[model samples]
Target: MIGQFPPIILASKSPRRQELLKLMGIDFTVVLKEVDESYPSGLNPTEIAVYIAEKKAKAFDESIRNEIVITADTIVSLDGQILGKPETADHAFEMLSALSGRRHDVITGVSLLKGHKLYSFYELSEVFFKPLSAEEINYYIAACQPMDKAGAYGIQEWIGMIAVEKIIGSYSNIVGLPTHRLYRELCRITAQ
Candidate 1:
């Protein structure tokens, strides 16, 4: 790990997050914990993301300490509404249709917990898509069942290869983790 504070623990079960951490060369262990991913009705997308990450961190066993525990949550925002992983193909299609040719935001929240200390932050990226035809959307949908992804799409997938026109922020944020900000934060936390 860059910081060398202690062995890191990942509080999420997301393979995307694990892959990101691995790419960053950060050694970490996994402790899958489920937390209610709810938020206050008025909270914005970034706030909701951070709150969910904190919730996941708190879900860990109380015996956890000393080691740094990293938890993260991601969501898509368009027209002031938050979009999460779809439960079905229909839901995924609906989400993609809503985002077709529109600019949306992807936000990822990270929470670092070490004993009594807790730190949380969020990063946002703006993604714009070209107007996608129904045939194109259907083709991509059939090729990649993105029901498990937010905004019913993955920026690293087939749809992204064609539909995504411009991205105004971190690419990793849309993929799920925001590794640059995460690296900096890890350095700061360990330097303390």
Candidate 2:
């Protein structure tokens, strides 16, 4: 399947995204370019994600040619507020505490750029967490060190194994990329 596509460049530093792309059988190279991730305040989670993803893609404008450049951003939203990567263990605990016994939306926005053409989309997944005790949260934090994950958790980590009660959409989206949607988009773009 990957043989049908053009040369690919994945513009992200995330190991999870890299692993997911590899698992999809898509051959690609990892390229990193620093881009400001901040977005306008009034935008919703989906918009914020897509905006950042497109911003990352634009950074490669000077170097792009026949290669399809892919970039993505994932954000966790609870009650309309975004919970970004936790900067500290204490912050992770706070984010996890607020997420305990609650449902949140994980939105991953993807952008594909080839030359001057750009395509962008977003996928949202609903994740529900069973009520977590302080002990459980503390243990997961100490064991997983979820400081680098959005909402202070990774759907594929120790916290997910014991805490995730249910999910209503793509599991891959919560992990930071929507594989099914991404695959479809890639097929569409590469066919053009």
Candidate 3:
């Protein structure tokens, strides 16, 4: 039986995350807060993602109680450099263009905060892209709002079908959350 607790809270504005949670039958609320994503320069991709996720969770006012809080941060890394959200259409174009005919890593950091207890984990997925044309990149950038997405692309979008040649890990990780890891972690939190 499900234990009686406050409704789970998701600290994100991503519709994909929200929908994915819904698909898992987890009831949650979208409570987004602005947090500075800047992290130490030396941290690896997973560390950076985890650090930012925890930072976002910590940003929530301390007044909240009981309910579990889930927060996440995702980053796309190529050759050890993190490719974050695009600053402009051209930036998105550049990111995608570079990714063409190459494989990149998408890392997502997930944090589950229940009261004072905090658990954090990260998942990385390798995404391969077929060599794409400049016009194709431009079309994707213009058609999809890449500014809000990491790696300047969305895995569930049209780009995923044509541009993504293969995925070596959890596809959901590229979407923002690793559902398999998240489900297990959330269950552990509930079991505790």
Candidate 4:
């Protein structure tokens, strides 16, 4: 499947995304570019994700040749409010506290740029968390240091192992990238 695609460039600094791409059996190089992830007002979670992803892809506009550049952004939204990465341990605790015994949406926006053509899409997953105690949340924060992840948590970490009660849609999406959807999209684009 990877052979069908052109040389791939992953324009992200996320280790999870890099690992996921490697696990998908796709050969790619990681290219980091600073991108402002802010979105305009009134955009929903899905739109924000796709917007940031495309914005990141656009950073490579001047450098891209024939290689396919992939970029993605993931966000966790509770109700209608977005919960981005925590700025401090206290903030992480607050975010986790709000997420306790609640359901939230984890949306990942992805973009693929090749030559002059660009495509963007998104995947959303519903995650339910069981009620978490203060001790549990504090412990997870101190031990895991979830300041780098959205929603103050990683679904593959200790918090997820103990707190996640149920999930609907793609698991890999919550981890950062939607591998199946990405693979299908790659196939579709490469076939064209």
Q: Identify the leading candidate in terms of lDDT.
A: 4
lDDT by residue for model 1 (10-84), tens: 887778889989998888999886577878888888889999989888776385867889998989999889888
Summarize candidate 3's per-residue lDDT along 58-111 as a digit string, tens digits. Answer: 876484687888999999999998898889898888899889999999999998
TM-score of each: 0.95, 0.98, 0.95, 0.98
**Overall lDDT per candidate, in order of appearance:** 0.87, 0.93, 0.88, 0.94
Candidate with more favorable, higher lDDT: 3 or 4: 4
**Per-model RMSD to reference:** 1.4, 0.9, 1.5, 0.9
Runs of candidate 2 with Cα error greater than 4 angstroms are 1-3
The sequence of per-residue lDDT tens digits that candidate 2 reaches over residues 1-192 is 454788899998889999999999988999899899989888988899999999999999889889999999999999999999999999999999999999999999999998778899999999999999999999998998888888999989988999999999999999999999999999998888
lDDT of 3: 0.88
- Candidate 3 weakest lDDT stretch, 10 residues: 1-10
Candidates 1 and 2, the one with greater lDDT: 2
